[model samples]
Target chain A: MEVYHLYSGGKDSSLAAYILRKIGYEVKLVTINFGVLDSWKYAKETAEILGFPHEVVFLDREILEKAADMCIKDGHPTNAIQFIHEKALEEVAKLEGVERISDGTRRDDRVPLLDQRKTRSLEDRFNVQYIRPLLGLGYKTIRELTERLFIVEVKESEKLEKSDYEVELRHLLRERGIDPLTIFPKKHLQSRVIGWKKEKAHL
Target chain B: MEVYHLYSGGKDSSLAAYILRKIGYEVKLVTINFGVLDSWKYAKETAEILGFPHEVVFLDREILEKAADMCIKDGHPTNAIQFIHEKALEEVAKLEGVERISDGTRRDDRVPLLDQRKTRSLEDRFNVQYIRPLLGLGYKTIRELTERLFIVEVKESEKLEKSDYEVELRHLLRERGIDPLTIFPKKHLQSRVIGWKKEKAHL
Candidate 1:
C-alpha cells in the first residue's frame, strides 16, 4: 500500500521517510506550502536527494494568519499548531490513493501534535490510517538516525532561512506589529538534509 | 585526557568508542576475559579494525562461578551482573594513566545498569570519572549507528558461539544441574562486530 508522508525536509521528516521506505512501503513525500517564502525549497531538494516521488500542496495564507491569531488569543501555540496540523492532515487525506498519512512526530515533540482524540476523529471521518513511525523514538534517536543517514546542516529554528508553518505564522504576527516572542517559546532546533552517503566502517 | 572504555565488541561498546574518539579522548579498549570461550576474540578483532590500543584482562574463572551462584540464589542475574560489572570497573580503574572510565550504557538498556548510588560510590572510591556517552540515546539510535559504522553479525544470545560473561554464567549454571531458563530471561539479542569499512559519507 502507498503512504503519504508529511515531510518538512527537516531531520525528523527525512528520517521518517527513511523508516517508512525501509519497512516496505511506497512513500510519497507531501510538502504543504503555506504561501511562505522559501518554505518549500529545502523539502523539494531533500526529496530529490532521497529519490522519492514528491508533491507540494499550497494552503491559503489566511490559515496561517488565523493560526497566529489563535496563538495570540490563547497565549500559546500548542492548540493553534495542532489545528493547522489537523487541517493539513484533512487536506492530504482527500487525495486519491493516499490511504495512509504519516509524519515524524517523535515521543518528545510538543507542537504540531495531533492529540489522540483528534487522531481518532480524523481516522473516523476520512477512513484513513495515521502512522507515526518515529513516535517510539526520542530526540536523541532521531538525531542519531539523521547523522547516520544524511549530511545535514542544523541550526536554531529562528536563524534558518527556510521556514515552516510556525515560522510563517511568526512572520505574519510580526508583520502585524506583534512581537512573536510574546506568543512563541525560545530556542528550538531544526535541520536541513543536504545529502546522504552509503553505510560504511565498523566503529 | 585518557579514557578506558569497557569494550564488548557489541554495537553499544563500539559506538561508545566512536563517541569517545569523536570527542578527542584518548581511548583504550579494555576487555575482560573470564576464561570464557570466545569472550575476547571479537573485542580483539574490533579493536584492530578501529585501530585503537587494546588490552585483554584475564579474570579468574571463580568470579564467573560466584556471579552464577549469586544469580541462582537471588533468582535473578541483575545483581550478579552488576557485581561483575563493578569488579570490571574496579580492575580497569587500577590501570596506570587511566583517568576516566566509560561504557555504552544507552537510555533503554535494562541489564548491567549502574544505579545512581553505585555510580557515586564508584566515583568517590576511585577518584575517577565515569561516562556513558550513549546514556541519552536509545536502542534505535545505537542500531542505526552500528548499521552505518560496521558490518555486523547479530544472533540470539543463546545461539551465538561467541560468549559474554552472562553466557559463561549460564553455561556454568547448567553444568551445576540448574536450568538457566529459571534464572535468566529468554530472547536476549546480542551482536558481534565481525568486520568494518571506513566511513565514506558525510552522514
Candidate 2:
C-alpha cells in the first residue's frame, strides 16, 4: 500500500515517513509550499537523503493570508493552523492512487490537530483513510525515535524557516504590519532532520 | 489564614510550601512518618533551615504495609499512593485551627493525583479547603522556582532514602519477598531536597 505522507522535513514528519517504510508500506513524501520563503528547500534535501520519491505541491498564497487573518481575528493561531492543516490534507487526498493520507501528529501536539469529528469528516468526504502514525506517541518518544533514526538539528520554532504552516503564517502576518507574537505563544521548540545514518541490522 | 502543608522535604513539597508563604499565608509544615527509615529526617532539617514551624506526625506502620499490599495486588502503585495521600490529608485536617491542607502536586505529576470527585469529597466531608499551590505549574516551572529560592540537591527516587510514598512501599514489598519492579515502572526520576543556602532577601 502506498501512503501519501505530509512531509515538512521536521523530526515528526520524517520519523513518520521512516516508520511507514519500515512497516513495508510505500511512502510518497508531499510538501506543500504555501509561498513561504525557503520553505520547501529542506524537505527536498531530506527526501533525497532518505532515498524516497518526493513531490512539492504549490498552494495559493491567499490561503496563508486567510489563515493569518483568522489568527489575528481570534487572537490565537490554533484555529488558523488547523485550517491550514486541513487544507493541506484536502489537497494531498486528491492525488491519484492516494487512498491513505498520513501525518506526524503526536499525542501532545495541541494545534494542527484533527479532532475526532474533523478526522471522521475528512475520511468520509474524501473516501480515504486519514492516518496519524505518531498519534499514540508523545514528544519524548518522538524525540528518542528521531535521535535513533537520523542526525537532527533542533532549535527554537521561531528560528526554523522550514517548519510547519504556522511559520509561514507568522511571516505573512508580519509582512502585513501585524505582530505575530500577538497570535502565537512564545518559546516553542522544533527540530529539523538534517541527514540519516544506517543502523545495525537487528532483524 | 493558616494552611497545613504536607511536607516531604522533596523539591515539589518544599517549593509548594515556599509558594504558600510568599503569597502571605501562615504556613504550618506537617510531615508524616509512616515508620519508613530516614523518611522524616530530611523534613526536620529542611523545616529548620527554612525557619518554619514544623510538626511530625507518627503513622502506624500498618499504613505503609496496607499501601504496599495494595500495590502488590494491583500490579501498580498509583492507587496505593493516592490512598496514603488521602489518609495523610485526613489526619492533618484534624489538627487544631487547621482549616486548609495543601500539597506540592504539579501539573506534570501523574501519580498521587486526586481526581476532581475525590477532591470535592475530601473538602465536603472535612469542611476544609484542599489546596495544591503548584497545581497549575509544570515540572520546569517548579524546578525554576526551587532554583531561585534555595540551593537543592537532586537524586533519583530509588537512590534516595528520603523520598515519596512509593519508595517506602517498594522497600516494604521487597522486605516481604516481592520484587518491586514487577509493580513499579522503571527509570522514574524524582528529586530530594537536601540542604539549602539562604538567598538574598527579595521581599
Worst 10 residues of 2 chain B by lDDT: B194-203
**B-chain TM-scores per prediction:** 0.88, 0.89
User: lDDT per residue, candidate 1, A45-163, as tens digits?
Assistant: 77887788988888877778788889889987887888788788899998876778888776567767765567667777887777676654445445655676788787877776543
Across B1-203, the per-residue lDDT of candidate 1 in tens digits comes to 67898988877788777766653468888888787665677688777877778888878888888898799889999888888888888888777776688877765567687765676677668877777666544454456556777778888877764535677788888889998889877777778776664553212
lDDT of 2 by residue, B57-122 (tens): 777788889998889889988889888988888888877777788888655567677765677677
Question: What fraction of the true interface does each of the listed models get right, in terms of native contacts kept?
Answer: 0.00, 0.00
* Candidate 1 pairs with clashing backbones: A201-B149, A201-B197
Give the clashing pairs for model 2: none
